[model samples]
Structure formats: structure tokens, C-alpha cells
Target: MLPWDAPLAGRLDRHPFTSELLRGNPLGDPHERPLWVYVPPGYDDSAERYPVIYVIQGYTGQVTMWANRTAFRPSFLETADAVFAAGAPACVVVYVDAWTAYGGSQFVDSPGTGRYHSYLCDEIVPWVDAHYRTIPERESRAISGKSSGGFGAMITPMLRPDLFGALATHAGDALYELCYLPEFGKAARALRTYDHDVFRWWDDFRSRPAFTKPGDESLLVAFGVAACFSARADGTPELPFDPVSGVVEPQVWERWLAWDPVRMAPGHAATLRDLRAVWIDAGTRDEWFLDLGATAFRDEVLQSGLPPDRLHFELFDAGHAAVDYRYPLALKWLAERLAR
Candidate 1:
């Protein structure tokens, strides 16, 4: 594919959104975020309202990355437009931005990361409903994402059943013990150069190529997630493990465990049962072992009494990166079940 913008049969409206909740965040990340809304073909010709699917990004992803063209494939926008053009179920798609100075906010509310969850549920959802020809009901809305975005998708519907009744997660982060703990060792080793201070590592990280160092990815992810999950009241990110010794700090680590989707499912059983549709899939060879997380999450949802008919779970044959092709698949699956 050419490294240029491609045409879409549907209309993709771009808007700049200023979030009151994110204003003056401790990180000083941008308050003005780019928001993209894709209206399917013939959206304006009729007075009919459409269901909405809110699309979130993975860690370190920005809104404009949705338009990025791959070597021989079309971007997701084109694929999704083809879904509508082929007379499949039609819905409005909203792409959200939740980036931070440290890479991403994990789309959660934290003293260090800002009130990103509130910004999405309270501000962005309402703003979209008011500005578009949307159905304006929880049953008509769904959320979908991959990785960190996948984690947001899994939890958002459970947290706000009044706003979203359906969701689709592609290799979402879960089963924290398996997914996160192994990285602590790598991060701890990387911290040696900075005297076991993550902030010092952060300073050095910002001054050069992001992942040039051996443990840059491990350290960056650990730091970013710590900011999202275990920030102190003063907005300082506190590592869940000792940066030098790699010892687990029980209190801080528990905070991270509490956000794990597999662990949270039991408490949110009623909400999951009330959901209209839930789609989940992960690559069998996911480097992070999120496929196991997917299985655990699906089992918990089942044990929580979510009806089998309302669910679609799968294990695909692939790895984590370059799975953008899966987005449109989940979008169509969710669209079929959403209120028409």
C-alpha cells in the first residue's frame, strides 16, 4: 500500500476535544485530543439513528495511528468502510485518544495519569451522542480495543453498564500474575543505570531513541503502568516492585491485581450478565500469554452467569503484533448484536 491517506466510502469526521477532567493533569499531557467519528455510507441520507462502537488504542497508541497504512494492506478505516459498503450491519465508530507523556494513560483514573476513564464515559460518550445521529442508549453502544485498549474494553462495560451493554476485546491484558510479574525482573535490571530510580530512567528515556536500550520496553511499560495503577495521592508513580532488587511490594502490587480483568469479573458478575453481547479473542501464541488471560476471563464471565448465547470467544492462530485485521471482524460481530 502507498504511504498516503486512502479514500473511504464512509465519512470520517475529525474533531479536536478539550477535556475538562484532563486539564492540568500532573503529567501535563495534551488536554486537546483528537477524536474521530466514522459515519457509515448513507448515514446522512436518512433520519435513522445508528449504534456506536467506541474504539480505544493499545499502550502508546495515538488517534492518528489508525490511518497508518501497512505494506500491502489497507488501513482499518478502509476495511471497516468495506464492511458497511457490503451491506453488513451499520454502526458509527468513534476512535478515542488517551496518550500521556509516559506513552499512555491506560485509559484509567489515577492521580498520575488523570481522569481518563471519566473523560471517556462522561465527556466523550455524551459529546458523541449529542453531535451525531446516534441511538442514545446503552443497548446501542459497544466498546472494542486491543491490548491496553482491550483491557479498557473488558472493564468499561462492567463499570458502566448504563453506558455500554456490549464489548469486544482483542488480546486484552489480564491474568496479571502471568502477564506483568515476569517483566519486573527486566525492568529492575534496566533500573541499575539510573540508581534504581525510575524517574531518572524516565529522564534519560526522553532524551534519546525510546527503545534503543536493552530494557527500554520493559522499563517504559513498567513505569507507565505503575503510574496508571499505583500512583501515590500526590500523583507520583510508585513501582509495584523494588526497582533494583525486583522484590514485590505487596501493597502496591495488590492495587495492580485489583485492576486485572480476570480478578474483577467475580465482583462485576451482575453487570456482565446484564450485557447484551460480549466478544473476546486472543492469539494463541501471544507473547504476553494473554491468550491464557482470555481463557480465564471467558471462564469467569461464564461462571458469573453470563448467558452462553450472548458471548463469542475464540483463540486465533497468530501472535500479538499486526493484528489490526481483527478489528473489523469484531466490529461486525458486535454490530450484529447491538440494537438496530
Candidate 2:
């Protein structure tokens, strides 16, 4: 538990990681939108340099999710500040909202989502480094998040070798399991069968969620898109995977696999080699986020011949949506390495 008596309450930036809108994420599409961020407290005052943490928010979350005006900042920082202060200066924390109002940004560089991968790695990282007092190298940077955001964090550095050196994910989706054989397809149909009434789907979805929102803002977007679920009532695609066509034209599994981190990772040997630390954690009771997949990911790193210690895996006793509980540990582990 975080020591509430710790002095971090007053230690964080009076504000938080600030928001910046990076439009047209190398998508070559004008409709490409802007994503936001929250820079930590001391970013403006220091030229001495800092490591960076690209902490992503889940599908249901926005950039403001962790540093919410309500219950989180004080909750996390009370212990974290001491950890950071006692070591190197606390690194810069970045909160990148993965998507706009849609429930699915799988963090993939889709022709659909306009190459968000390039936007985050190519445009945003460099922008942050040039504008901020950063170590300006991948080894001093980290990425972390929960659920979908967790998946994003774990895979981003592997995918973007030159960008981040370390990653810490908590309760992230085992995408290898869900994307190929999603158990919740029928649930999507069951809720949508109730039809386009404004509040009906949302009420039902919350009443008995087969799958929780990937993060903060995602649920709202998912609920809003209930009328267009391209899958049928029995877990079959309304169109089919072969043609990659569906009634509503949802992004297909094949295109998704091309970008799925789990599938794409096996080939990134050079990038995987660049990792300074590769750590992932999830709750033992988190049925939605699997410990096995993350553990397998760690093993994948080892089998690739990256140092064994480069991959750290832990299973905590908890369930999903435990950010209030899991993230401080991430900060501690992250500081232990990047703060050097």
C-alpha cells in the first residue's frame, strides 16, 4: 500500500503531463485526428535532463485518465515521489490517449486508424525529445499501461526499436488469444440485438459485461457503436474472414494480424535486442488479462537470447481495473532502471 503520509502530495506538478494535439499521424489522411498528453510537474523547470515514460491509456481512457482531477494523482504519487527523488530525478511521465471516440485503436498502424504507430513513434517521441529536456535516447525511456494500453506498451518498443528501451505493462490484453478466438463475439451480438435505442445497449453492456472496456473512454465508444457490430449472434462474422468483409466493414482479422504485436514480435530480433528492460505484470485473478500470455512474452524475449533479467514477469493477486493498485509498482520498477 502507498504510504499516505508520504510527502508526494505536494510533489507532483501542480498540473500534470500537458496535452498536445498531433494531427495527421503520418496517415496521409486529412481526417487523421489529434491525440492528447499530460507532461509531469517539473518538465518545464529542468534542463538537467530526464528519462521518459510513455504511459498509455486504455481504450476506455483519455489522456486525463490517470491524472484525473479526482482520485488518482495523490493516490499514486505519495509513494512514487520518494522512490523517484531518492534515485535519479523522477522521469518525465507521458500519458498518450490511444484513440479518439472509437472503442478500437488496437495501437496498430492500420490503413484504418491512419498509422497511429508512426504518429506516436515518429512524430510524438521526437517532438517530446526536442521540446523537453529528455535523455533523447531509447535506453532512458520506458512505456507502460494497463489492458489495451498495456498491450500497447509491451509491444510498442518491440515494434519501434529506436524509440523506447524499456516497457512495463499491467493487466494488458493477451491479444494473441482475443483477436484470433474472441469469446465475446456473441455477447457483442446479444447486446446489439436489443437495437439502436440510445441507452439500452449501454445499460445492458454494463449490467453484465462479457468484456470490460479496454480502458476509460473505450466503453463509451463501444457502447455508442453497438448498432454496427459486424459479427452475427452466434460469433460468426456477418461477412466472413476470407473476404475480410462484414456488413459494417469492421477492420478484419487478417489485417489485424499483420499488425498484432504478438504475431509481429517474433520477427523483430534486432529491435528486441535493443531492449534494456522488458517487464510485464498482471493480476492472478484478472480473467480478462492473462498472465500466461505475458509470461510467454517474457519467455519469447529469453528464447530470442535477450538477457533473462531483461524480461521481468510478476503476477499479483487482484483483478482488472486495478490501476489504483498496480501502477505505482510500475513507477518503482521503471525508476529503478531508467533513473540511472
Candidate 3:
């Protein structure tokens, strides 16, 4: 497990709830993909179907990253009264661990990662709706994420309006500018040397051209996901932290392109018309270098001719701290939309 991953299993207690995982699900390969499920207290034998939200995360972040990464339960609960607090028409929140590290999984289909888009749309969602007492109707299903996840929520609803009814995003991770950079190119070439677990391969990504330093993710915060979503030749995952290998793999770059929501959104303009609701918000003070870019994406998306009522965009005075202002607003926004 990555260093950050080690802390998660223990911190599970922090939540005022019980969480479970799926092990050995060869479906979301590379890392054994698991679904972290949280059923509110009132979820006991109620025989009622609840709404569901898929919470995705940025690069390098796992499904449980938000749970372990932030102190959001209290605020998120109150803001999303339906899911968190007293269970007012309570719902289910699903966090699917997407691509991490090397740099990808805007949560779409990619040549490198097999058919993740199909997996979520075809497998994951179906599994959730089948097993859980979820409100299986598209109107009852919602999708949201932070940074890269935000991009996924934005792009997914636009592409597959039939599956998800509502969308919410915060401090989104938009990859409009990063894919063409030199480092991404280099990593694409050296994909063969990737170290699946310990990044026992390639040199640190800091040396790549025009690439943001691993820690210097000023323009964006999708690196954690970029690494996971990115794969080396032969279906191996890329390790942005690995320094001995010294470069990017080729298919890795393809995977990056595959997940880039910016490149694909323009073509889906008409699809946006079907969306019931859409929301985009980010911290103006976000350290990620792409706050301006995030705003630009929101504007461009709105300009795509989707009704003004369907698009919701906001800029707040917060930085990139998770579980604080952003989380509350995101959940509240989703609740409001799903209420419709």
C-alpha cells in the first residue's frame, strides 16, 4: 500500500459510521479496487430505497482518501441533511477509488485501464442498485468528486445523462493543459519501467519538462489520480514517485488523454442538455495552478447551450482544504438538486 494508504485502515474509526470494502474484485485491477460504502444510521431494515452519490477523488487519492483525508463528517452531515444527519429521506454515498498516481482516470474509458467507464456505468452502478436499497432510478443517483473527481462528475453526467441525475463538484481537477507537457510525454515512453506498488521504477517526475513537481501541483491536484489511472506498457501502473526508471511510458500518455475531460467535453455539448442539474465550485485560493482554468471550464460548459438553471458555478474564499467549506457546499448542492 502507498504511504497514505497505510493511515486509512486505522482512521476508519473517525467516522461515526461503519464502512466496508470489497476485496479481490479483479474488475478494477492494478490495485484491488474496493467500494467504500456508508449507510446512514437509519439504514437499518427500513425497506426503503435511498438515493446514492458516487464520490470520486483526485490523483493519488484512494476511495477512502476523502474519509481519511478530511474531517468532514460533521459538516457534510448537517449540509446534506438527507444522508448525514437525522436521515431526512436519507441516501447512500459511494466512493469509488479511481486512478491514482502517474496521472489519469478522469473516470472515463481509456485504452490503458480497460473499460472503467463501462465498469462504473455497467458494473458498479448496477451492483449498487441491485444490492443496496438504492433508489435505482437515475433521478435518485448522483455523482460528485473533488479535483479529478470533479472533472469526472462534470464529464460523466454530460456523456451519460441516463445513468446519473445530479452532479456536484468542488476544487475540480481539470487536465486541459497538463497532458501535452513534456513529462507526461516522457512518462508515456517509460511506462515499461513502472513499479506497481513501491514505485520501484522510473526517476521522480519532477525532472520532466513543463511538468508540475509531484508536490508542486499548483496548476492542478490530479497527480494522485494521474499516477493510478496512468499505466505503463504491459498493463502495469505508473509510479510518479519512482526515480530509478527515469521516464514516462507510452500507453501511460494514452491513458492520460483518455481520461482528460476537457478534450472530450466540447463534443458532448448536446448531451449536457439532458442533465437534470449540474454544479461546479472551487476555492479561488486553491493552491492548484488551475483555479482560473477551472473557472474557464465552468464557463465553457455553461456556454455549451445547456440551460442556465442546469448549470451552477461558484467561487469561494477557501483554499484546497478538504472536508471544510467545499464538502458542505458540495453535499448541500447535491441534496438540493436530487430533491428536484
Candidate 4:
């Protein structure tokens, strides 16, 4: 692997985007977000249009983290550049930022987080298409991500079949009963310090170094996801489970279940059928048990009538944290099948 800060054959362009949709959001996050686009090696030398891949991030992941270099591993940007330089299919890769003060936007539109879904589909997609040499069609466009971003990839194409037609999810969140319900009890115990009120936990969280408290991560996820999935109309995050008792609030929790890809696939059968490619993978030992979620998602998509030939599914040997190497693999897979 190349050393950190090595030069790339391709060029990465960073653009600042001010979103009208996110202005004055409940969390008071900045509306001006950083947008990064990676153009393949020969992009500037040729007039050819390219397929586009939208890269979404996991919870609490911001755009700059894509450049994060681990020991003996190059960043995804470098590895992806290698793919193009070696003459695999070329594409324009877009890294989107959907961060909120709590951690992430979950890439959904809610009264609590503002219209992030609209910002991505209606604004960012059009902006990128208008400014770049893109095929500008759903068949040539895809979205990929891990965790929360993975959930976004799984649903965006279904919600807007007119915009995206392909997706790759690396242990993307799903099978809420398995992936999420387990977290409820843990979060409830953590909520004890704050009187079983997530807002109180939130206020204390912002007052000091994050994650310093043992319960910070679990509680943050509880609040952040609730903010994304079940916030009240007035913009207050409503926990799907009672924070003190860990009792499932059936109605609120159902709203969260409604977003699970496994449950959603049956309703989006027509949309899944139109997808050119779908890649689903997870570590067999994923802490969240997303490997099970992946299997369930694959089975559900197949039952929804997506051609078996169009999907790629795998359960690898590792867990969820250091799965960056898998990104380029999926990119290559998608590049070959995307309209070229």
C-alpha cells in the first residue's frame, strides 16, 4: 500500500454547497456542507461522460473522514484511483455530507433533521449532473455506503426510482429487531444517569468530551436515530422505546421498522426489479449482527423479484469497523455493470 498523503492519478475536487433546505435546522448544524467529487484519471483530458457513484457515510461520519488512513492501508480515494488507472471502468464518485449536531442526518427527511433526503436527491444530484460530464440517468447512477449510509443506499433508489438504479451496502443497517432492539436496553440503562430523558443525556453529551461517558454512544444513537425516524412534528425526537424502562413504543418503533430494507423490499418490488445491480455484504461477526440483516435483505430482495443474476452477496471474515477495503471491490463490481 502507498504511504499516507501519496499523490493520486485521479483528481478530487472539493466543492462547498450551501443548502437552503438545511438552513435553520433544529440542530443548528451548518447549511454549508463540503462536497467532494473524484474524477477518474482521464476526466480532464477527454470529453466523455462517466457513470456516477454517490458515496454516503456511516453515522457520525463526515466528508473529510474518507481521507482517513489506517496502518498499511491507503484511503478509499487512492484505492479507487488505482481501479481507474488500471483501466477498470471509470466513474465520478461523489462524497456527500449529511452531518447533524447530534452526529448524522441518517440521510432522511424529518422535522427534526430538516430535508436531508431532498438535499441529496433533488439538489446534490442535479448540481453534480449540471456541473460535471455525467450520463445523467438512473441506470448510470448508484449510491453506496456503510451503516446508516448503507440504509440510505438501500432505500434511496426505492423511494426515488426515477433518480438512482443501483446500490452497494456494506453491512448496511437493517433487520431492526436484530440490529436495533438490542441497543434499546443498553440505551435505557445509560439513560438512567439523565433521569431516563434522552434530551437530558443530549444536553450533558454536548457539555463535555463526547463518548467519555460509558453510555454516550448507545444513547447518542438512540437519540440520533429517533431524530431521524420518529421525531414529533414539532421536531422533538421521540424514542421508539421508553428510555427508562426499555419498553418498546409500538407505534413509534413501527415507524423505524418501516424503513428496514427487508420489510421495505416487498413494497418496493417494482423498483428493486428495475435495479441494475445490488451488492450486499457484511462481516459474519458484525457486532450489530448485520450479517443476518444482509442475508435477510438478500432473501427479501430475491422474493421481491430482483433477478438473482443482478445481485452480489457475501459474508466475509471480519467485523464492521475496518471494512474500507471492501469499498473498492463493490465499486469495481458496480462499474462493470453500470451503463458505460
User: Model-by-model lDDT, in order?
Assistant: 0.93, 0.57, 0.57, 0.93
Off by over 4 Å in 4: none
Put down candidate 3 lDDT per residue, 1-340, tens digits, no spaces: 2323221111111221111221222234454466766565556757767788887776556654443433324323233433355334456777676653344456765434455566678767887777777887778788987776677777777667788877887766565454235343344334443443233222445346535433234222323444336644454544443333434445555665555556566777776655667777777787653466467767667767768887778787777665345665566556656742
Worst 10 residues of 4 by lDDT: 1-10
lDDT of 4 by residue, 1-340 (tens): 6565988899999999988888898878899999999999889999999999999999999999999899999998888888888888999999999988878988999998889999999999999999999999999999999999999999999999999989999999999999999999999999888888887888898899889998888888888999999999999999999876899999999999998999999999999988999999999999999999999999988988889999999999988899999999999999998997
TM values, all candidates: 0.98, 0.71, 0.67, 0.98
Please give the lDDT score at residue 334 for candidate 3: 65
**Worst ten in a row by lDDT for model 3:** 7-16
Residue 2 error, candidate 4, Å? 5.1
Clashes of each: 0, 12, 42, 0
Query: lDDT, candidate 4, residue 242?
Result: 81
- lDDT for residue 251 in candidate 3, whole number 0-100: 58
Candidate 3 off by > 4 Å: 1-32, 69-83, 86-89, 99-104, 178-260
340, model 4: CA deviation in Å? Answer: 2.2
